[model samples]
Target chain A: MKRVGIKDVAREAGVSPTTVSLVLNGQSARIPDTTRDRVRRVATEIGYAPNSVARSLRTQRTHTIALISDRIATTPFAVEMVQAAQDVAREHGYLLLLVNTDGDHDVEREAVDALLSRQVDGMVYACMWSQVVDVPAGLPAGTVFLDGRPAGGGFPAVMPDDRAGAMAAVQELVDQGHTRIAYIDAGEEPVPIASRLRHEGYLEVLRRAGIEPDPSLRVEASITTAAGGVAAAGELLDRPPAQRPTAIFCFNDRVAMGAYRAARHRGLEIPTDLSVVGYDDQQFIAAELDPPLTTVALPHYEMGRWAMQVRLGVLAAPTENDGVHLMPCPLIRRESVAPPPAQHPAPAGDGE
Target chain B: MKRVGIKDVAREAGVSPTTVSLVLNGQSARIPDTTRDRVRRVATEIGYAPNSVARSLRTQRTHTIALISDRIATTPFAVEMVQAAQDVAREHGYLLLLVNTDGDHDVEREAVDALLSRQVDGMVYACMWSQVVDVPAGLPAGTVFLDGRPAGGGFPAVMPDDRAGAMAAVQELVDQGHTRIAYIDAGEEPVPIASRLRHEGYLEVLRRAGIEPDPSLRVEASITTAAGGVAAAGELLDRPPAQRPTAIFCFNDRVAMGAYRAARHRGLEIPTDLSVVGYDDQQFIAAELDPPLTTVALPHYEMGRWAMQVRLGVLAAPTENDGVHLMPCPLIRRESVAPPPAQHPAPAGDGE
Candidate 1:
């Protein structure tokens, strides 16, 4: 048996194929409702499938958006972001095509080209980490970056206020009587935007309190995994008991878990012996920890929604000098931190 | 600045636009390399961007695959499957366009229509759990389902051999002298294919050993979350101490965690008091559990790889009679189980 085509629907409905096409494509707003209904009913009865590719050719819009992330599958934040983006896209009758590049510039370039080839109306480029790089040339103008500063400028972005969030974490620690707090960063050299902002926030809070920063208390690790956090904790513990800080701030939750594990291994009671503060309230880490972690919550889902809105033209296009849209990160205080021991002495230089 | 057209490239390269189009589309097997190079260079220098929509119109190939999944962002296994599919697609110069339907039929229909409209070369349909659904009409022939048995047959699929894997778990328990094994299945009623198959395997193994199946020993719950598992375990433990089974088999790792919690709550020692075996060896549940769980490792990554290969036509299409591609679920023996206590007397009813 031969498949039914648009011509058969038009013939059955006593109309032209063009009329059937117009009605099926939802351009029937100007057409008579009776005629539209008749055509639609006939088409449905015959199972007349409209050719989408042909329709797309007639109208330049593909009703599709491309989301290019630098390895979104592995990152918790990226997962939330993608979910939010999908939610917004579905609401707007658009489909999201996600492409993960594994942070490779070449792959990024190829992905962009491929999305463009598919005629995606717009693009959202979300990097795993905010690192400076030259934007590849030849992309369509309707592109925006998510959680990163756009290279070569002009593109809009949505990012968390890392500095303010970090400042809040430290300020809370200070309010709780922590004078010699150590910032254990689980990120490599030439830190990414979030890391640098967080580090700066740590310093600013200390400066405001008139407390001189201790260089010995600052630590860095290669990655933000729990193992990296463990290594950093090991280094801190290796120092003389008199020199160790009362509390430690981790870069993220994974690092904090490692710190918790290391402290457990060393027979140090959490909060009672050494308070540990974490960033990014990842659920698995926070819920399963022996005593839940006190951490900063990054607005990943909101960022994703904003990213999609920006791409869909629902939000205003970013202008030059618009700077970053820094969403606030709130602190979720669980059972991880407490005041220092009464007998522990303050750092010697801070008293001066 | 005005956009450079294909005509401009043709003019610069002293060739027809059709010739230039053919060479740029990689249909240059018949054309000389020197001529192809000249056309490409001219196109690049003139900043001529090919109109991909027009190219697609001529070729009817999008070089894109639609990966329709039920909540790709939240389901860990689904995320890995999509990533593996993307990796495979990328190798073949195909882009993966993802759509998350959240298991809503309306959303699924919309996504299917949208992807179909985009003229995706093929489709990979992955669901969080298997259920019966009519295959949407008017789709291309290359669409395949993952983790779902094809409706009305003919579509290729990749799924675990739940029955065989379950039998292995049961056989292991039986070998350890667990005659009265409890099956705490924390899965919804009209159980998923995996659960049902595994249950069948469980029943088959017991019958073969000349043991009458006891319905009291089998309990079902709404889901496989740790909390659900805990609830199922609690119900099982409600039976008098004398009648409780010597061993327990959980639906998955999450459920197993709940079982561990339940056992701990009742002051029952793992393995010694109650031996437990789990399925789907999720990392956190296996590694972080107090005694570490003895669970079956599902080949998540390999399944992902196979799903991609099958969709891309790199692997042979499976037939309906082939049923599930049962991957081996080798038990990872941790400290979770041991032989039943020798002092405990067997329950009454031994008249043969």
Candidate 2:
């Protein structure tokens, strides 16, 4: 099929090509609405796509943005950030050029170079997980970081409020009247910044509740997976009946799942014999567990939108100290939390 | 900092702007290696980036490929297709323009129009799961379909071999000496094409093995979630001991997880009392299941790479009937499959 152009739409509408262009581009203030509607209808009928390449050269702005990510494309739920960024870019008449560099420096450099060559108006540097990363050299000004912070922070960064999220998770258990709560920590060495912050929040909540934080109540998982949760929860549940924790707070939903398995293996019922709380309300795992998990949701979608807004100059970068935007993490309550069993003593006329 | 230009590199390298452009563009065959090396080194040192916008205006080729996906960005594992396509496009000196429409037709139309205006060299219409869809009108030739086939069937398509993958999953069970197999099907009416194909594969394998397919053993889940699997698998497992299925094949990993819970509720041990298999070897769920699941992997990465190759003309589109490229789905063996318990004779000193 012949490629439709402004000339084709003009010929079909019986108007000059310049008139067609003006009407279609919304630059025809002097033209009647009837003529503008006719030109647009004719253009749509004939599929007359505007040549952005030619327009880009004349205007010197391609109306394109580059979203360079460190493996966000391959992860679950986190990709919502990419989707939000894309939606914002599209709303502003810009297309997104996406590049996933798999955290390889060489690939990132090449991707940056390619995006620069394409003359994208701005860029968003996103990470799969919240962390402190070294921003690559040669990134043009106006690059916004999402779910991460620059190591020597000056650029605008949007990340989840890990400490607040942790506090919320622990507070949920506290609200349920559980005093002896055990924590399964994601304890890889050089503990991740999130792990540290969440740990601090857990400690704060316990202290604020007037509960003495027991040293034996805290157990570290080798990793942050469900398997890790199982191993760590096993340790806490292995204690004598009097010392066993009534509730367990996990690092993330994956560990929470492991904890579920551990409880089941020991014939403990959730929200009955034991209560559990988790973090990172990851899709599928959080709401889909046997008894849906109560977790803290990372505001990935909000962070994504915020990052794009900063990059597009729709939202100004925070000028405060550290220049990081902390998006709130809300606690999602489900069926996994309840009062301690001791609070629900059996009636006097029961089995005995 | 002011953007460095070709002239800056030319001046520093002691060469004309045209010579520098030629060297950077890799059209410097006649130029001496020493001159080429100097020009490249100076370009790198001064950070002279090539202007693709102007070059595209002159060449009429934008060197950009648009990947339009239907909710792929939000799903797990399937985004690997996007990554694979990006890698291939990058290797060929092109950038990927990604747009996810979340299966909204209006959004899809707008996205298609925007990409068409941007003058992308090619496009890839990707679906999150394998199915037949109507190709949107006005897309240029050379557009490739990934993980889906065009309803009218005239375009190049790359999709997983669902039927073959199903056969493989069942064959693994047969190899383990299972005959009393049940299927936990994704039972929504007008079943998804993948479910239909996989179900056919299961029936074909049973018939080929001389085992009559039992209608009661083929239970359907209302949805393809882990919860659905539990409901459907519960019905199949609720039978008397003599009538119980020796194994179950789940529609997907989510359902398999449900089956796991169902079996556990019935005091059945996986691979000891019953064996199970699942499809879509989703990350975190499949491999991370307590006893790692044995499942089939949808060749998303391969289909992605293949689609890109077809888009880039690196590989020729199939000339045969249908023009759909069937990428093989590989069965990933874990600990989920085992010989039927009946196949093992009781030892002399057994519990009985």
Candidate 3:
């Protein structure tokens, strides 16, 4: 059967094409009620799909995609992710519409509704460090999840391979001839899948190396801000020098920055005094620090591009669906980490 | 005349209230031709207004406002402005939708169109820095400009008192007992009204003090990034140590940070070796730097809140409207500036 067009609906309803266009586009506020009803009824009966793509061809798409994050402006990683996302979006004839929801469910609901109302061809829902938030029912058709896994089913999502990324960070610290390594976890619990996976990866690496994970060496903070990282660092540094871990692995760049500041405040030099490793290599933070940070680079730009493509309905659901796309998180070796301090003698624990 | 309700329209059209709603809301894709036409004609004959506010009362207004910036992720001042805007928007039960246009006119057009399509109750158009960009014609009613004066001038706008702000920076430097103070202006030329006012402010203070405004001391950089500031610093520093200005006043915070980096790289101590003042006191950059920066603070949050309230029709337009709301820019004193080094004697320059 031939596809129905606006002309056909207009002819059937005995309304002008302009009337149909106005009513169909939801600009019916300016139109008289009688005409709007007639046009809509005829369009519906004739099975008109509104042909948004066809409409877009005539009027160039704003070449912009909406990026809705829980609270992006304050989070450094989120800010960088948005920047990378905008870069990628611009490369593909699109701009980024970034909305900060402040993690309010009502706000999130309103944001989604507003984006839909704007007729965003696609959407990128980037949560700030994932937590299980209910995806509102009845979202605009083409939407993708970013930095988060779809909660109740399959949806196109882009997130780091947290398990592998965490393992790599831990493995690198182990390889640098450091046995006593501590983990500074910055996030609330029943941690996000990404966070949990990373934590598990750290444990897996420790287990494989025949080293027991010590509870005392693991520190958890509520927020992933630099201040939280500083607090975590304080907790780690309060232990006796001999009992302190030789190296530290931070949750992300911000936490690592905090750790750097904390170490300095305590009069300890980096690398020589205490080695540090961070994740999410944010350029500004990394470049500005006294000794540049060593970190794991999550493919933020690539993920953003892929998220848009997925929302545009270009990708089919993964056949071997694990419900997660685990992208590689590569390590960036910088001056922050080095061989453990030579002066301190090994603790009096059995080699076995 | 009584306000015509959906029921009244339905009664006139001899159709169900749902049918009138489908037509009025433009959900016409599901209705039939004959009935749609009859319903529309009857509704129009009765002159029905949908009363969006009443609809919102039944279903809460999205309560989301879009705070759109040309590009913010890379511009530190823009980022601070967005954060402030978000804070105020949230306080007003409104979420901020941030769009990065990358300073592209086409992108700005598209972003505005998208925001309008979303049915945002109000909008805040914030450009990164100030420039002469045409506001798209026929903006959906209820939009306000921020940090920029509208080109064709219909909307309410909020911008800093650039002349006053600039004068404050220069006056502060002068009062610290430095006759050889220089200015590094970074922005587009013909200069934004804000920059022009600032330059005027600088000259105003200089002329009042009987100090000849040296053309050599005023340098304009392409953009206000740290790199731009560093290059400007290099130009100033290339002069003989005795010839260099005692103090430098930067166009914005990023440029100041760059100057700070350059001075530190050249083994000069802040204030003691060289005094500096910046604009738009960005929090993160200011707090993290070694000697926290002293700069002018733009009232970003108040401006944003006021901008939104104007667009929301909550505030009446001022009678003596200058098309711009000039907020006071206050000095935030920190560790970055002090009296010039006592070792070097003050330079005797040629009169203008």
lDDT of 1 by residue, B1-352 (tens): 8546788899999999888988988999888999999999998888777666767777888878888877665555446667778888888888888888877878878788778767788998876555444676654575676766667766766776677778888888888888888887745554467778778989999999878889899998567776677788988876886678888998887777778778867878888888998987765347556567888877655666777787788987766564445456677888887887664577758887
Q: What is the DockQ of the complex in model 2?
A: 0.69
Whole-model Cα lDDT per candidate? 0.78, 0.88, 0.73
lDDT of 3 by residue, B1-352 (tens): 4557789988888889999999867788989888888888887788665543335434535465776677665554456567666666656656555666777777677767655544456677887665555777446544677788777777677877888988888899888888788888966744467677878999999999889988899987677767778889878877886668889999878788778868866778898989888987775666555577888887776676677677666676543565667878898888878888877454667576
Clashing pairs in 2: none
Each candidate's iRMS in angstroms? 2.9, 1.4, 8.3
Query: Per-residue lDDT for B1-352 in model 2, tens only?
Result: 6678889999999999999989988899899999999999988898777788888978879999999998854576888888899989989988999998887888888888888888889999999888888778666777899988888888999888889999999999988988889998888744388898899999999999999998888889998888899999999889986677999999999999999989989988998888999999998899888688999998888899999999999999997868998889999999999999964464657675
Prediction 3 global C-alpha lDDT = 0.73
TM-score of 1: 0.80
B-chain TM-scores per prediction: 0.85, 0.90, 0.71
TM-scores, in order shown? 0.80, 0.92, 0.65
Weakest lDDT window of 10 consecutive positions for candidate 3 chain B = B51-60
Best candidate per TM-score, number? 2
True contacts kept of 1: 0.47
**Tens digits of per-residue lDDT for model 1 on A1-352?**
6556789999999999989888988999788999999998998899876666666767877888888887755664457788888899989988888787887888888788777666788888876655554565556776777777667676677788889999999988888888888888856644477788899999999999988999888898667777777888878866887788888888888778778867866878889988888888875556456577899998888888988998888988656456457778999898889987765465767854
Least accurate stretch of 10 residues (summed lDDT) in model 2 chain A?
A: A343-352
Candidate 2 C-alpha lDDT tens digits along A1-352: 6678888999999999999988977798999999999999998897778888888877878999999998854467888898899889988988899998889988988888888888889999999888888878778776899998888887899888999999988898899888998888888744387888898999999999999998789899998888888899998899987788999989889999999999999999998989999998888789889899999998888998999989999999998858998999999999999998974564868774
